[model samples]
Target: MNQTIVPDSQARGLLARLPATPRALALLARFDRPIGWWLLFWPGAWAVALAGGGVVRWALIGWLLLGAIAMRGAGCVFNDIVDRDLDAKVARTAARPLASGAMAVKVAWAWLLALCLIGLIVLLQLHLYAQVVALASLALVAAYPFMKRITGWPQIWLGLVFSWAALVGWSEVAGSLTLPGLLLYAGTIFWVVGYDTIYAMQDREDDALIGIGSSALSMGRHVRMGVMLCYLAALGLWGGALWVVRPQILALAALLPIAVHLGWQVITLKEDGIDPLAKFRSNRFAGLLVFCACIVVGNA
Candidate 1:
């Protein structure tokens, strides 16, 4: 039952082949993990589809995609910089560039600044209203790294931070937020909370030892149930969002597949053998499914 990806020898071989600075920097940014961008991009897409009447906005979408990539990297770098000591103690994150001393803190901060500058450039392409909504997320992003230290619901904070793009996207398309947009944003928050809590489960043991807080620890023996509730709430809110936009039976029908898929995830989830990273990564597909539902309902 060697279910672990990148076995010890393979991991060692991969590390040996990696170049010094650039490769380490890429790893730190998690360029290898496209899931981050996918997660980030979805909220933007959701907003565009809902607000733009399901017509894709290619230019805005492209810019938002780039912004997501850069900002997610910046966020990761900042988190790593702040959590270097804690990352060093965690088996899964011990090899991170900051934690392993492959990159200096000052260098990491400089990299973060560069990425944020790029993100800001992308942000400026949007309307002034969208710009304000986008910039307002900075405080949430700033406070997120410290959340695990203070509350067992750090994933909740992460949901707020990660899904802020929904508001930005809606504002970019509509020039202002609407009730539908707000509902979509709320749904996305619950979605993030559910998936990220699943992700936190992978480091639950280490997190507990080091005094970190996560929904995984809070749920304790009922982690699966907690995830189910979170997922259900997400679905309910998304359905509500769609209802606000279009009250037809077809609009509700569009969500059925997504609901079934989420149910499958809940039923098939192996809480004991759960690989949090994989579970977290799986959310990209979940997001896509819901995005498709939104597009269909909105277009109809």
Candidate 2:
């Protein structure tokens, strides 16, 4: 039986040449899939830029980026540990390090701890207020992997998790969350819901067979419309965020490029095959577009 090999597998080329011990650990953390970290990083980037930031803000963004990478790796490892059984049943995930028994549970836990240590180092770069806010997300992050079993919309829970950097970024800069920051967080939650729904497309049939819940399965025939609604709401709230930052009509126009990009994604989305993955990964660019808008509006 052939399993799906997304471009992010670790059992290939140089990665495969690594010692078996490290290779299994790397695969468990999904270190090859930078898209996850990139998606995780963008919200914090957007918030920092939108706060009328300067050089110090750029430095902070660097810290947040590192935190995203480390924490994202940790999250993936934790999720793999939690979902090992389910992953073993899914064709797409059957080869995952933990699911395939390439890595031991105890070792996976140790790797998770190491990555979280990296996150702690990054956290020390932030202020006390930001540190507190960042640490508060632990409960949400801890509960995320189990969400799919109990909720039809686990993507919603993921949105809350992935979009958390917005709050941390805003607090790191401003020392408190404002209306604009809240709006940015809300909008990013919608954006996550949309992109992750596209990602869930690959698992819809398998998920149904296994009785797993997902936004893609929940959307059913209306998956396209569901993604479209999510993107539109994201744009609307982001627009409101920009307006709050600067009450100028031109500030609203800052979202034009991002709007066009999301429109393209929604217009071209397919429920099957690589298109969904392509569209889901395209959010990295979507993030950059939003960051540009935030820079324009916040600095105006």
Candidate 3:
């Protein structure tokens, strides 16, 4: 019997129309899944918007979008390279180009370099302080693929890696990090932890068998509550970020929409089947809600 490989539902779309090798390479980089970039882009957008640069620094937002796409793709490619063997053991990840042997490791490395080149262009567009802050994340990014092997809370490292854009965006717009930026970064970290934990639920059994750690497995039966707490913490920190900028009681209300949306996720969360994946992907919209709030508060 042949091993049947399964990919996540989001793995289809435009990339499906490409030639075999290129398609495989695109899958390796997760280009078909725009949500990854969207989630990565939002915290940076939140920072830019909250710094009152939503209109004045429109070009910077554009640059952050490009950087997010490139960097997120690069991260996925690097992760696939590192986890190819481990990926083969997970049903949802087993069809990944590297895991399935559809792409060579060397070719994947080249693709990773190509994505980094695009990231480098975006980096050059940032100011010195933001550039240094951004460079510091490379070490974190490099360390992330191994965290699952050593710790159950790998999502914490991912939060640190993914929320880094908040620092870069704040530094670029405000010329340095401050209370608002730090709070935004901290809040975004909890947001990442919440969503990634939902994502991890899909692989719990495989992760257990493979002897890897994940927040989903660690939270166990309390996964929904765990996610709820993470979301609550994210809102609190984000609310603080808004308060630091505007200081009005009404400013704190800016977070209400995202707060409601996150609450909906927890209330509707189901630990089985595709529910976790759906909730995980819903954060893209949640990110937008927060961005809108940032715009309202920052521009007010």
- lDDT scores of the candidates, listed in order: 0.82, 0.89, 0.91
Q: Is candidate 2 or candidate 3 better by TM-score?
A: 3
Q: lDDT score, residue 49, model 1?
A: 82
lDDT of 3 by residue, 214-257 (tens): 99999999998999999999999999999999999999988888
Clashing residue pairs in candidate 3 (N, C-alpha, C atoms within 3 angstroms): none
Ten contiguous residues with the weakest lDDT in model 1: 1-10
Clash pairs detected, candidate 2: none
Model 3 per-residue lDDT at 15 = 65
The order by descending TM-score is: 3, 2, 1
- Top candidate by lDDT: 3
Q: Model 2's lDDT to the true fold?
A: 0.89
Quick one: best TM-score, which candidate?
Answer: 3
Whole-model lDDT, model 3: 0.91
Q: How much is 60 displaced in model 2, in angstroms?
A: 0.6
TM-score of decoy 1: 0.93
Better of 1 and 2 by lDDT: 2
Tens digits of per-residue lDDT, candidate 1, 1-300, equal 111122112244454566676667666677667788889889988888877545668788889899999999999998998898998898878877788777888888888898999998998899899999999999999999999999989999999999999999988887789988899999989888888888787888999999999999999989889989998898888888889989887887888877887787777777653455656677788888877887887677
True-vs-predicted CA distance for residue 71, candidate 3, Å: 0.5
Q: What TM-score quantifies how close candidate 3 is to the native fold? A: 0.97
